[model samples]
Target: MLFVTHVVPVNEPGQPRLDREAVWEGLVMKANNALPFVPAMSECEVVERHGDSSFDRAIRIQGDPYRERITLEAPHRVVFTRLSGPILGTIANEIEGDGDDMQLRFSFALVIAGTPGNSQGEEDYAKNMTGMYIAALEGTLDAMRRIAVDNAA
Candidate 1:
């Protein structure tokens, strides 16, 4: 098992601030509305949605398609578990407020043992890929912040 965590602060003065619940709502809404925060994600659509807490989506990133099941705990966190794909693991995002703004803390754990061949090399690759994924997510956070600010105007 390999885990990576990254924290991005969603704070900028003059930008409209969303309460915790609103932030969660926005996050779920974004998942349905074209996933603009993730430039690498070419397509995203909800295959199963039952309010904010449970949903399954098929996402295509760089031409590879995969499905993820997300379970949300309002105002604070969402857990994403891969149902089928090249990767196997769970990714979680924990959100909270910082004064008028909020912070998004992402934690990812990849179950490297499930990989085919399951060699040391695969473990190393999973670790490297985890780092890259976290970096991309940080970029997504930046894009989200920009969108939030723009929406406020």
Candidate 2:
């Protein structure tokens, strides 16, 4: 498994003055049909809302559908475990601290399964995917910040 973590400080102008809980409640929870960060993805189809802590959804990306089971820890983190997809493992978005001191971070602990027997091929694949994933995360942070600010108001 490869674990990658990215953190970005929210310091954009005109940002809303909302705390971690408020951001989680207003923006994160309400974002159901589409993910706030992922680019070039279709709207998600929510399968089940398992109480306040978790939910299940299928999101289509590049014509392929990926399913995940998501769990929320109020005021702080949201964890997504791939239930069915090309990648298997977990992605966690965590908000550290409170108020103006909050920092947003994403930890991606994932593995590309089903590709056994070829160690070199797996290494190449992992390298390529990690680069792509990091690029995607960069694009996502700005959007997430925007959403957090907008909803925080």
Candidate 3:
């Protein structure tokens, strides 16, 4: 299995400061439709709505289709579990700290289906995936900031 976690400070100098509500709203938006936040995703659709806090989405990333069940823990976290995809595991986006000192954390524990655990190939793949996730986190923060600015307007 491949496990990695990355955390980024949500408040940065000169950028629109995003409060917890704004950040949470951005997360919810991304959970429902990731195309605006995830550059690699070509399509996203909510396939099933479990409730106000959970749903299943079908997404195409780089032209490959995948399904994920998303659970939202309101102003705090969003968890995405792979339902049908090459990789199987959970990805979590979390908000840590409070007020002006908040941070965003992204973590995942995933393994390719049919692949041996801890193999060198899997290690290399994990590294690549980590980079992509890092970029995604940055993009997410950027989008959140944009949302905050738009809402303040």
- Point to the candidate with the largest lDDT: 3
Clashes of each: 0, 0, 0
Superior by TM-score: candidate 1 or candidate 2:
1
- Candidate 1: regions farther than 4 A off: 12-22, 112-120
Tens-digit lDDT track of model 2 for 1-153: 666787766444575455555556633643464455566566687899998778998887657678988887776777888898887889877777765677777688777777763477677876776666555555555565666666657
Q: List all candidate RMSDs to the true structure.
A: 3.3, 3.4, 0.9
lDDT value for model 2: 0.68
TM-score of every model versus the real structure: 0.75, 0.74, 0.96
lDDT of each: 0.70, 0.68, 0.90
Report the lDDT of model 1 for residue 14: 59
The per-residue C-alpha lDDT of model 3 at residue 112 equals 91
Ranking by lDDT: 3, 1, 2
lDDT of 3 by residue, 1-153 (tens): 999999999998888988888889999999999977887888899989987999999988767789999999987999999999898899999999977799999999997987799898898889888888898899999988888888889
C-alpha lDDT of residue 68 in model 2: 85
Runs with alpha carbons beyond 4 Å of true place in candidate 2: 12-18, 116-141, 144-153
Worst 10 residues of 3 by lDDT: 57-66
